[model samples]
Target: MSKWMMIILIRNREFSKDMNGLVLFCISVFVFITCNCDEEETLEGANTCIIEEKYFVSKKVVELWPMRTKSHVFCWKVPPRCTKYYIKMVPFEVEKKFPEFRNVNGCCDGYKKVGDKCEPECLKRCVNGKCTGPGECKCNLGYSGTSCDEVCAVGKWGIDCKEDCECNNAACDPISGVCKCPPGRIGKNCEIKCPRGKYGEGCLNDCLCKNEARCHPESGQCICRAGYTGTICDTPCQFGHYGEQCALECHCSNGLGCDPVSGACACPPGFTGLYCEKRCEPGRYGEHCKKFCNCHNNATCNNVNGLCICPSGYIGEKCEQICPGWSYGDNCLQTCDCNGSYCNHITGKCNCPKYWIGEKCDQKVCPDGYYGPDCNQLCHCEQTNHEANKETSVAVASSFCHKHKHKQTRSVEIKILTKEERLIFQYVKDGDYKTLANKCAQGVNMNIADINDNYQTPLHLAAKKGCVFTLLTLLGCGVNINAEDSDGNTPLHIAVADNQSHICTSLLYNEANPFIYNKSMKNAYQLAMDSEDNGIKYIFQTNRLQWYQKIRKLKKDEKKLFLYVRKGYYGSVGDLCMKGVNVLVANVEDKENTAFHFAALYAQNIVPMVFTLLNCGGDINARNVEGNTPLHFAVMVGHVDATSILLQYGANPFIENNDGMTAHNLALESSDPSLRAIFNEPLLSWYLN
Candidate 1:
């Protein structure tokens, strides 16, 4: 509508004119309003929003990032001119609860579906345990199975240990990684079983032992047996018999004894002896001939009584010896000359005396290089060729009797077998000929002429060969390890001479008698010591380890505790101590100490100490128990510090007993830090005074 017309109509106030102007104005206003509404709708329909693009990285693939297209639900209004824009929303494992957005722009580049002519960058992935793209997946270690679809099996837990559990002896529960124990049992692996006569978590009950009997902890039973009774079956019958079977009895009275358990008479009432031999009289033995005889002569005719009698050669109350050499001879008739008695009364046989030569004459002779029936066996050794180790002529000398080393000839079958090659040595088997190397003089029965002692045993031959394996094999076959060679040297000695450590090792491994010294007085260890090669010595050293290994299994408790160090520390684990632990030291310097004294003196505490001694149950107050306590030691070192602790534990500060010194005296005498500190202790001032 025209402003002028509207104003003029209003000024004139003419009703007809004003109505006409109003209708015209209304038509114009209607057209303008319709046009503006159309424009606003067109602007809104522009259809471009500030595109928000989020890209998530895959944990599985890691390289590719998947994009999510979502626009901001609430955004800052845009200017009328603004049409298109971009906002990059980086997809992260931890998503943004709220993101800032604004109306802006557009873009043609968006993540297109796969197999569509898309680029490699479009393929999404899992980033940080999350899917960045459409088809991304990642599984942890145990879930390695396809798609991490499967998990550990029954009784299985831990990485790949599907069924290995700590229950049922490390049997894992199927669903949860828990353990299961056997029936009538519980705990980690169900290792502990219920004891007999009692059943429960720990077999803790008064009914454990049976019928008023006390049970052994391990055996879990009352000690009642066939002939025994009582809770632990520890007592015996007062009358005599007492044992498991009551097979004994006290027949130890009236010269008799009973079975230790049965109360049966082991010996008759009057008999007294282990086997109950004879009757025991008043003068009898101890408890039964259990009394002793004072007789010197070996002949004692009295039973029950231990009194002895003077036999033929003796005559005295105690029958100590021959009666003053008067000899009770000739039926005590007389003393005879010629050193002999007349003879038997009926036969008249001459009784020759000691050191006599002639038969009835009883003449004497000189000793040593003498000859005759009167101690006359003399230097029959040929004066000719007195030299030893001499070769002799076999022909005429055959008849000649050279007292020493003369050959005795005998017609015997002689056959020589082929020389045999063995792992040990080459042996020449000569048939049926016994050769005596060294012989004694005047050989009669003096020499074992028919002695069948032949080639030494296999052990001897093995020693000769110095073949350790052969030696070991021979020993394994029960060959005497100590068997001597012809030279009288044992394999042990031979092993030394040859310096055969390999053979020695083998021999020692099979218990080659390393300690047995030969006639030469040399043992294997000594031989090893003598050798130029250290290998032999090394073998000896290692042999000790093998020996200890064998015996280690045999011993237990404190004795088996093997203390070692550094390079030579044998069979030791960093933490494990089968045999306890101890330290080898110079004179066990102190009862409660380690070898750390030297190290500590050098101030090498930073050496990263690994206590090989471990907490080997070493005594802290061991000396305290003995009165020369650690407190005393602390004082001795001039360090009274440990004294307080020692005294607190009931260690007597004034206990100047075993070593003759109190902690105060020791502290007063020395200059160790701890002891010095102890001397100044006010509480100990009284003890010091």
Candidate 2:
């Protein structure tokens, strides 16, 4: 056979050695593998341990084994596994003493390292630099690595697979020996994160849903809200505000409060009650029906308006304010002796006297319409206007123009006028008494003087006022309404002179000529037109008045209404009085007289609804009895609403007293502004004012 064929044929037989010898070799390998896998003493029953120490001494080995003799053992003998076995030993009988058989520097050379001359049966643990499988195997519980060179990972508290493997109740794998964590368990040694859909120790607990439901992944169940129905309680109940839990029901009526969280049923502004089913009580309203108000002083309570009606003396909606115009003290129970217009009958807001509050009473907001303290008086125009038109009732025209030109600077004079050429000069030069001017216009009359000063009469003054009434009055007396003045300007000219629109309406409604013009070639209607002042333009372009009734009222009716009111003609208040005619518009003054204000000065009780309007919205800081609030007036007069309303809207009862007394102090003070004395504190002051 060839050498390769011969090697193959002997290989199997070589592996199959002597029966006993093969068995022994297999047993050694088995022991070695087992020792390498485990080594702790605590696992002694089944654990393995490998031994690498020399148990037999050289001489003892030789003496013990005398079976083999005269055979030389040739082997490589660095240490352990690299030795060959041969038979050689000294016979025990050859020794001198039978006890000396164990002692000797000799040994039976059975095994020898391969390629070496000789090797003893006993050898070191390793050959060359290699220790085949020497030393104890495993590291201690806290230690690990190659040949026990490394420590174990944290929290692992264990020895080998045979020892205490401290894995948290999780069964470790058989092969790899790592923790095979159950469902939901994770981490190295199964000590970390839980599974995706499971939670709670070993994922034992399931989730629940009530009415309204939402699913939770970890627990594989539902979260529920009120009035719902479903496996997860995710469905809401029919027409009910809830989920499967069925916890909540709708809580509301027509319109009322709503649940803060669920946004169930919201309430309206004023009404508050269970389900919002009820309206507010007579005087009680708002949330829970808590806030209450009453009228005090002379104020009258308005149920519908929830306000206190201030009487004349009590000038506030609550009637808690003193009369505005001039009255003060005790709900305006007292009035200052110095008078013109009086305090408001509701709020005690001050109403300064005419020529005091300026034009429109809104002059404070007027750009140039008014000036000075209290914003009283119209802006005066240039004197040149007066001088230029001197001979033609110039002073009146100039004064009118000056006052009207509050907003802008517009020159209307034909030529620059000198002060020397003023109205006085014309008056002085002509000195014509009741004499028709050089040009007798259609409305002029040449007659002797018999009327008022200058033979001009009140009509002349009215003419000076540049109103339609003046010309009409002259016309009624057969004096031409179109009469020309010494400056050759007619009544029509005077009426449109300053572009006073109201004059155009008045004159046109009467008999003043609309076509009449001056040397400037501008007619009355043209003069009425405005390029700047929109208000003036509207007056010129729009309707003059509401109707004939209004016009007549503006003229003849003012007197009638006044007479009726003064005479106390009992009727609808409107039927008997007018704002400027009989009574001023609420708190406004009329001709500097305040009868309505005086009437409120003597009240017994007050209303509330009216009081708040006058107090908060109206002016209530008027002074009658040394500047007292309407509270003083109502207290003196016993008006209930006045007091309640004032307090509700934040009226200050501790306000300073005009003469060192407050409204409360004034109650302690004297009865009237003129008659009251002064005191230091409110109580003392109350006795004085």
Which candidate leads in lDDT? 1
- Alpha-carbon lDDT, every model: 0.40, 0.38
User: Model 2: per-residue lDDT, tens digit, 87-111?
Assistant: 3322231111111122222212343
True-structure lDDT of candidate 2: 0.38
Over 445-466, each residue of candidate 1 has an lDDT whose tens digit, in order, gives 1111111233355455455566
Q: What does the lDDT read for residue 372 in candidate 1?
A: 39
What TM-score would every model get versus the actual structure?
Answer: 0.18, 0.20
TM-score of 2: 0.20
C-alpha RMSD of each candidate structure in angstroms: 35.4, 30.0
- Badly placed stretches (over 4 Å) of model 1 are 1-425, 428-456, 468-477, 485-488, 548-689
Query: What's each prediction's clash count?
Result: 55, 127
